[model samples]
Target: MLLTTAAVMSALVLLASGGAWAFTGWASGRLDRIDPFGALGDRPEDGPRGALTFLLVGADDRSGLTREELDRLNLGRDEGGARTDTMMLVHLNRERDAISVVALPRDSWVTIPGHGPAKINAAYSFGGPQLAVQTVERATGVRIDHYAEVNFLGFLRVVDALGGVRICLPEPISDPRSGLQLPAGTHVVDGAGALAYVRTRSTAGGDLDRIDRQQRFISALLEAATDTRTLSDPARFTAFSETVLQTVTVDDGLTGGALLELGNQLRSVSMDDVTFTTVPAAQTDFTAPTGESAVLWDTEAARELFGRISRDEPLAEPSPPAAAQAGGAAEEPAQAAPELIVPPADITVQVRNGAGIQGLGARADEELRAAGFNVPVPADNWVGGTVEQTVVRHAAHRADSARTVAAALPGSRLERAGELGDGVEVVLGPDYQGVRAVEAAAPDSAGSGGIQAATATDNVCA
Candidate 1:
């Protein structure tokens, strides 16, 4: 997300100034000479005035790497040119208050313009940026206004030029596959280390976990890069710019002039204002038709999130605190109630008895019904464990539902119960107690079983 901010700001400033245009021409000429993706073609049509979009690609190529460094990084064959490992589309509102960057996993199964359904990253390899852009546009229905690709070598150079970036590690991270080793704590990572950190995917969560770490690192990098110390130092700024400019390949529209203007526009924005989140994904082991096991994107949430960005909107904020903290509060009589949208009944509310007592399910059901949900039937069997807590289950598609359920049961143990087909399910734990309801109907189908639809219609635009 921080990278998105930096990338966008860089584009705005560089493109608005004539220098950016010239730099882009030069960059394009260089890329043309390489022609790694084959012959370059005419550019996409620039849309009428509206939101500005940028597609940031992180390539895995290490052609610029030295033999010693390649051995150090454990990099295999020289990939010749670049292969995009990460693809993110960032949409900035015309007003610039809000920004959204949607990350598309490299392994996602998508239909390419000419190449049928293939790994999303293959589009870049098959036809280069033009094909990659077309593929993403068709997949998400979001038009990309510009593009930028950062090779691994370039990323390292920029990181080194920025004097390294500071990153916080909650636990020791070691990935022999990526040659990244760090102890638990805050560590300043140089360009090579940062690249390894961002590219690591051998941990428990795999690529998803790697993306989360990358997002955090990007946030830290943005904060560091925008610091007065870095920005005010001409030597540092120029070095950073040159390192970035060399490693980065941008569309004709993102010339140096545009980047300068963008930087000026975003001068007032702070690091805290920028946020990053991945498109919701299901923890699935399903094999693609190609027989490769891969995590699948939750199509519903992914589409909605991307649609918002296409319209230049900020992500929906986290659920309100009051709603989350309302658990177990005594009901007030004849008092004016704040207007808040109640999550649909279809949202599964799992009642778990954390109290380690009998009749907990009954009590939980009563509490849930009073909270405006139609309580589902309490399971006959008890969910026994030392870690006593209530849990909720909704399809990965029902992100809103998950948020609502989590808010309703604040401070309780919450774990993603994986993907569900339709409705939400609340399983009462043995510790649960209070009034009981036999079965609660889903909110959407009036009595059918399915996850609840999103209740709020607020535009994603911040």
Candidate 2:
């Protein structure tokens, strides 16, 4: 249905060092190519030595869908054109252990070389991938060594081939525009559902939330793609590989051997090594000379960000709190403050009925999900038996995530547990009331003073 995630994650998983173990030269040889950088001039200088940066875009091509399929999928009639629906930069550090998938907002206001200022996406509509690459390089000063684009198909095939990918939502979304309808909870979705999930932006934070969905789905797909069972099964891997080659069009220079070499370098990479974030914005709505409202990047912040990328460094470290900065000694953030790095949507939760009331746990689960917590599992009996007071128990390392949960339960007390792992557990007591809405910590509030970021290991879906 939609090829958004494959444009980056699958490429990162299947084409880069991870999927090349069984991938043959024949498979790489079959990939179609469009030289994205060949005709461009005044390109930016190369980035950090030994680092590889690839620009990936999802090409919303519907030519392959039949009339019935298009109608069924609700994809409009074919509009013959070259335009990308979304764009992302995939950067791999020199040793290839760490990677960052940075989302570039399509509506970012930027100069398009000869085209002057326009929405970043307009570059592709004007000159296809060539100008798109040129514009991005000109705007960010980061050299793109390779490019690959995904069309409208194969996303479904890959997800279906793997049975399905697991997804967890903090809030329920019902967007008719994208034909996505799902409740808030743990879900293992098939191909069609995956398409709808990635395409819908009706949720809160709009594009930012959509980026979160893509990152989550990508993590799930990559998780399935790397599982020993899927890799060992020749039929499944072959089918998945075929879909990847068919759906993706790479730059002529991104050859099979080149991919194999990079893929092998990143074999040791885990989901934790990959970070997902969006480009920081100074203004979300800037009026252009053409009367278009586009996003504006925070110049100074973005420069430092791109410099770090060019130098093959991780994201800028978050700043210390005001108190810590003043005292020169680090201290825990004031409790009950909305300063958590892991947003509520990213926090995994389990609801248990300790109040002894039938179905109370399920109600709490639904209420928590409605309040934007990821309740991956349904309500259940409390493990430690009944208690008089509601309590939030979590692993010590996950105190921030735990605080996010406690914020939803007005009077819930905090407890530490070693067995609960990374997720937080809530045991409802007689004092338990209804859930209250809680806002995720703002980016600036989180001390990044940039855009929010998370790894697959930290994201809710994974």
Candidate 3:
């Protein structure tokens, strides 16, 4: 899904600026082209003039690889038809300031226009690119402005061209079928190893787990491809872009000149402005009408997700509409939701007994530990007046970590305390609810409360 989009976005980054712009104008002609929309008369209407949405797909078709290549790569028998290994819906806001890459679960149980009920990936397999586009548009209700597909094989070449990518697993991962085996540590993986790493499917969460890996992988890849040294080197940029373009096939409209224009528009997008997430799934083991297992998107949540994109609204909670201006209204600037980049295991918190209930601080400390945060020091008494609302206090620099702490404690308020220094304090109050079962995700508060996003950089205020 994002694997190819990562390459495309990274390519735009390299082509937008630097001396490589003209070179990409020439190289764009080398990109594989397809007319995926010509026959679709019922396409979704064009959205905001300045906004753009791209459907990026990665094909796992093994039919094209030679016998020797398959043997070396451990690719199984060809499935005969084209099925998307991964799919992502990429939205670029009108301002070109933020990008959201939403990974579409290939196993999603969705209706394929004329094909009745089946897994979403089957759309590509049954009707080629046209049906895939139509199916996604029908399901998500968001007009896709452009389309691009990539062969997963290209991922290897690009990674190798960039001299491998560095990734650290907080835990070990092993998949014999894909031949991806790695211990819990940081390592620079080459092309084949990178391929195996992405294609591995031994995780407990199934596709959900793979999506997380893909997110981290794409983020890491983008970081590597956009590294200062890589961009500064013409020879390196050319090779990397060539390898990427070779693997991608876009719709007829995305021409060489169009790509150059896109490059310029996206030049301002920083790593922090880009976010990788998945469509919220209500059920992962849904039994479809066809009696096959499939992922089912939360109908309401998925609709709201797309509707927000359609309105050109920020993925984060929408700021209260600017009080009607004197003469005219103002645009609601994009606010990315707060996302937890650092793992809970890496964060430390000190519980303070402000509630005065017996062993309140100790109970809070134990809950936080079970929730995955580190608490090295024992609980302490707050000694202040009786507290009402629980508060997570930390220095300004640790706001992200503080958010994690606050998020772990439902209804807790996050605050900055100058005296706290490097220490983070969670003062349990009388109103303290039990610790929230957490995940490595942006806090998706119920209702219209502004959406908080977790990003690697916490890119705020441009």
For this target, which candidate reaches the highest TM-score against the unseen true structure?
Answer: 2
Superposed Cα deviation of residue 216, candidate 2 (Å): 1.0
Better of 1 and 2 by lDDT: 2
**Residue-wise C-alpha lDDT for candidate 3, range 308-365, written one tens digit per residue:** 7887776643222223332232222112225553357646677888888988888888
lDDT leaderboard ranking: 2, 3, 1
Clashes of 2: 3
- Which consecutive 10 residues in model 2 have the weakest lDDT in total? 318-327
Best by lDDT: 2
Clashes of each: 47, 3, 9
Deviating ranges (above 4 Å) for candidate 1: 1-48, 282-284, 319-462
Worst 10 residues of 3 by lDDT: 328-337
Could you give candidate 1's per-residue lDDT for residues 1-462 as a string of tens digits?
A: 112323433333333222343254454344312222233344444443666887877666666778888887667667576567757776667875545555677777779877798888888789887788878877777777778766666666667888988765534677887788998566788877876777777654567556655655655566566667876788987776666566666766654455556655655554434545566554345588889876576576666666667656566553222212133211111112222222434333545454456666566667777766645556333344433444554332234454454455544333332222223445444333333322322222322112112111111100
- Rank by TM-score (best first): 2, 3, 1
Question: Distance from true position, residue 447, model 1, in Å?
Answer: 20
Q: lDDT winner between 1 and 3, please give it.
A: 3
Deviation in Å, model 3, residue 357 alpha carbon: 22
lDDT of 1 at 8: 35
- Which residue segments of model 3 deviate by more than 4 Å? 1-25, 317-445, 448-453, 456-462
Report the C-alpha lDDT of model 2 over 174-258, residue by residue, as the tens digit: 8887777888677888887888888887853566557667877787788888878878898887887777767678899877787
Against the true structure, candidate 2 reaches a TM-score of: 0.75
Candidate 2: which stretches are off by over 4 Å?
1-3, 16-23, 287-293, 317-449, 460-462
